[model samples]
Target: MTTTTSSLLNIRPNFFYDKVINWFPGHMAKGLRIISEKMSSIDVIVEARDARIPISSINKKFEEVANVKERIIVYNKCDLAEESSQDIITKAFEKYRNQKVLFTNANMDRNIKTIINIAANKARENPQKYPFVTVMVVGMPNVGKSSIINSMRRLGVHRGKAARTGANPGITRAVSNTTIKVLENPTVYLIDTPGVMIPHIPDPVCSLKVALTGGIMDHLSDEEVIADYLLWRLNNFSNFGYVEKFKLPGPTDDVNVLLPAVSKRIGALHKQGCLRLSGT
Candidate 1:
């Protein structure tokens, strides 16, 4: 639970870390523009975020574009986060009484129905005016947006995955041409949009959290920096799960000391027998 950085000693500054301040690419801009254009048709905006890094995963730009629509903040991948922390995360958003926050595990179909019901209920507030509910699903990359859409389709229509799901980020590149129908009674359609990031992530730590959680592309950030940050995070909470997982001699704060040991323990070596610290 500690946030001290004294453990990270003598680490050289990285170029990628410095440049990641303005990591926004052109595609993100285009995606934002597309979302803005479709705001007129969207009845509800489902903002998906990683349950582990809820605060950092949120795209601040969505607030400006989706402020008018009914926003449902879904903290996806709840199964991966600590169950005890859910209430704490929920309470953090209590101020947003206008917005509804739901923790969901899309892969397991948990809370899928509730999310649909909430969106439907919100849209039905003006049933005659808004007959068809058009829900726009937005979130950072690799946060299970497509998985949630697919789950909704499975429950609403008993159909298989309509939106493609992947383990990495940026799978949904842009808004799809075809609409995915999630419910039949009230006729709910979901518009799957690409995972868009803010134009600039001013805080480096926030950027690292996003990178470590796979919100941003892996190649965009150096592997070692991300791994190191992960190590620091694990050590901060005194979570030595990695020590057992990697079969290390003991828990160490220094990634330099840890990575080599991990590389050796796991036999992660090059063809020439050199230890692959980066690979580890």
Candidate 2:
């Protein structure tokens, strides 16, 4: 294990290192159009964000489409984030009049009932407006939009998955004709759209944070840079669980030292002589 420590490592102010990330694709454009067209019928907008990177995960483009709708901010993957940070995140959205913020672990069904109830309650306000409640789940790539719908379906209707789910980004390309039914009483349905990312990231810092959360495509950004940013964040926060997980002698801020030890421990090897640690 590499145990040599150099002078105090200054946290990198930026992770992009002057690299530009182009992540928006044709599918996202079409998805945005579909969402815009369907917003008239959408009674409630369940904006799902990655709880770990709550602020950075916000798709700025969504503000135009979702500003007028009844929005509930569901910060999914709460299990992956520090519980102490939830209150601080929640306090940021206190200015919104009709918006509700919730932290949920969709995989474990935690707070799924509350989400459904909130949406259902909001939709029920106007019984004459529509026959059924149409709720749209929206967010950046791989922030668990489909997973939240699937969880709500399993709990609300006791049914199988209505939306396809995966760990990678951009699984659902469009809002299909078949909307998933999450609640039967008063007739509630969910529209699962493709994970939408902002067309232009404001800066390199925002790009790296979004990329680290898997919001942007992995190939578009250097994995080593992303990994180094993660290490810097963890070390800066004094969180050193990676030391035990990677079998390192102690915490190290250098990605060069940590990556090699992790690669050897995880047996990551490329076909050629170079070591591959992309998925680590």
Give model 2 RMSD, 1 decimal: 3.3
Compare the candidates by TM-score and give the number of the best one.
2
Q: TM-score, each model? A: 0.87, 0.89
lDDT for residue 257 in candidate 1, whole number 0-100: 74
Model 1 TM-score? 0.87
Clashes in candidate 2: how many? 0
Q: Could you tell me which 10 consecutive residues in candidate 2 have the lowest summed lDDT?
A: 1-10
Instruction: Encode model 2's per-residue lDDT on 1-280: one tens digit a residue.
Output: 3322242356555444667576889999999999999898888899999999887888878888999987888899999999998988777677555468899999999998987887677557766765688889999999999889999999999998888888678888877767888998878888889998888876787788888888887878888888898998887676777888888777877899888778777778565635775563
Model 1 C-alpha lDDT per residue in residues 1-280, reported as the tens digit of each score: 2223354344334323454534566777888999999899888899999999878888889989999988899999999888888888777778556558899999999998998897677556778887888899998888899999999999999999898877777788888767899998788999998888877888887888888888777777877888888876676665777766776656676778777767777788677766775435
Q: Check candidate 1 and list the clashing pairs.
A: none
Rate residue 249 of model 2 by lDDT: 70
